[model samples]
Target: MLRTVNVTRYIQPLREGGSLPALAEADDDFKYVLKFRGNGHGPKVLIAELIGGEIARELGLRVPELVFAHLDEAFGRTEGDEEVQDLLKGSQGLNIALHFLSGAITFDPVVTQIDAETASKVVWLDSFISNIDRTVKNTNMLMFNKELWLIDHGSSLSFHHAWMHLEERAKSPFPFVKEHVLLAQASLLKETNEAFKKLLTPEKLQAIVALIPDSWLEWPDTDESPEALREAYSQFLITRLNHSDIFTNQAQDAREALI
Candidate 1:
């Protein structure tokens, strides 16, 4: 489970994407990039962000520390912007945040080259989660202190939006790997996939899925309990990891075509 923090101030709204995440100061005297629960996708996006990010970290990738940010009901009452005010009000509860990287710049593949191992790991992680982002146009990666850091995983695990035939979805070939920005550089897919499979055991996956907030799992008109939802996510990931070869082969073939 993630440590909780009280949001002290709203610094600014990050308008990079539709979700409208913000840069804010927390009670711990540190700034964080806060993902609100009031966003259009609601808590589902937060759930994806947490699961994808933690899994990446466990796979030895650079991911910022995550925390559960709390918003008071009156936090944004005086804001003159009606749009911002409504968003704040609706998100007056537990939200997700990442430690803000102060001087990070968007990753430019042209300027900086990633080695085969790192690129392969990133590609494998993205494929495992079925992440739709991380294309050449929008990498959703940052270069902080000359090291690559991943962020904005809200778009992964899209199966949650329509939770039917989840096991079938887990076995998807993930042909989208052809468009991944790092696919060409992921030359060690086979080796990396085998190594990563050992790192993410069923117990580790269950622990990660258990971090999802109970409130977030309470989907509208859904009959499933939070525990059941967590189990579903865990099972989906376990099944996907077990059948890693489907996507690994897809990625290897895609990489071969590029080369």
Candidate 2:
């Protein structure tokens, strides 16, 4: 289970992407990159972040700590920027935040050469989740303490957005692995693919999917209940895991073309 923290301060907004994630300090005196629920995709982005980040952690990959952040209504009144105020007001309930890595640097493929084992594992994990953000343009990874840590999974598990023919989408191979920044280094795809299959069992995947807050799963546009939505996410992941070969082969073929 994830810990919940109350945001004590609204530090500054990070303007890199459309979501406008911000740096804030919590009651625990730890700084975090807060992903607001009121932003672009709303709670769906938070759901993806929670699910994707936890799955990466379960695979023994480096990922910053994830926590449930509560934003109070008072924050909206003090902000001078009308846009920011609206964002805060809209996000008054619950949000998600990643523990800030104080001196982490953006990952540069040229500067940081990952070993085949790690690279293959990362490739397989992203392929499993269908995360499209780990490209050359936006690696969504950081180099902290000489370790590769993944972040910003708001674009992951994208099948939830369309919410149609989900089983088909789950069984589909992620062709975008060709564009992954680590494709060149992912030489152990076959070995790691088999290893990861054992790591991400159906029970484990369902447990990670269960981490998503009920509030986030209550889709505003959908008539489906929160429990149903959670079950859908769990089943989708399990089905994808059962058919991991489709994506693993696609990634291997892509890597072969690169080398």
Candidate 3:
């Protein structure tokens, strides 16, 4: 289980995100950008951030530390804003806390020189997760201490939206990957494939999926239980990894056309 910290203060809202995540102070005395399970995208997005961000770290990407932040309803009583109060009240249990990177600047691919290997790995990883957030316009990357740090994966794993056709969707090709920020500079897809193909085995995939909180898995509309949903995501990632070469090739073609 991830280390849990108590949220002590609701600092401010980050209106940049569609879900409108907020900054807060935690018992750990560290500030965190808090993403609530009760947000518009719901808990699955948090699951995606957990699963996807961990995978990126396993593959040696720079990702901000993720911790589970506990919210107490009493904190809501202090907030004067009704909208933020409602969010705090609703998210009275566990939520996602991304360690606040105080001076990190958003990465602009045009002005930055990301190495081909790292760029390829990031692009390939996004393709695997079907993350559509890292475009030229919204890279979802931060440059801190002169290194790229990935963030905001609340929109990956689209197959989970329709679990009945999970396997079919997992095997389907990705057409949106062409616009990936790293695609144009991802010149080492082959090496990236060779390295991670051997790394993200079924056992590893299962372990990563298992990290998702059980509470995040249960939804009224879904007949599948929490464990079943975990299994579904594990299988989806493993299957998607098996078929990664398809998108790798697609990225190479996209890169050739762009550069």
The best candidate by lDDT is 1
**Candidate 1 lDDT for residue 53:** 98
> Candidate 1: TM-score?
0.98
Q: After superposition, how far is residue 17 of candidate 1 from its true place, in Å?
A: 0.9
Report, for all candidates in order, the number of backbone clashes.
0, 0, 0
lDDT by residue for model 1 over 9-75, one digit each (tens)?
Answer: 9999999889999999999999999999999999999999999999999999999999999999989
Q: What tens-digit string does per-residue lDDT give for candidate 2 at 80-189?
A: 88888889998987899999999999999988899999999999999999999899999999999999999999999999989999999999999889999999999999
lDDT (tens digit, per residue) of candidate 3 on 3-78:
8999998889998888779988999899999999888768878998898888888888889999998988687797
Would you list the clashing residue pairs of candidate 2? none
Candidate 2's C-alpha runs over 4 A off are none
The TM-score ranking, best first, is 1, 2, 3
> Which window of 10 residues has the lowest lDDT sum in candidate 3?
158-167
Best of the two (1, 3) by lDDT: 1
Superior candidate under TM-score, 1 versus 3:
1
Worst 10 residues of 2 by lDDT: 211-220
Error of 2 at 164 (Å): 0.7
After the best TM-score superposition of candidate 1, give how far the Cα of residue 151 lies from its true spot, in angstroms.
0.6
Per-prediction RMSD in angstroms?
A: 0.8, 0.8, 1.1
RMSD in angstroms between candidate 1 and the native structure over all alpha carbons: 0.8
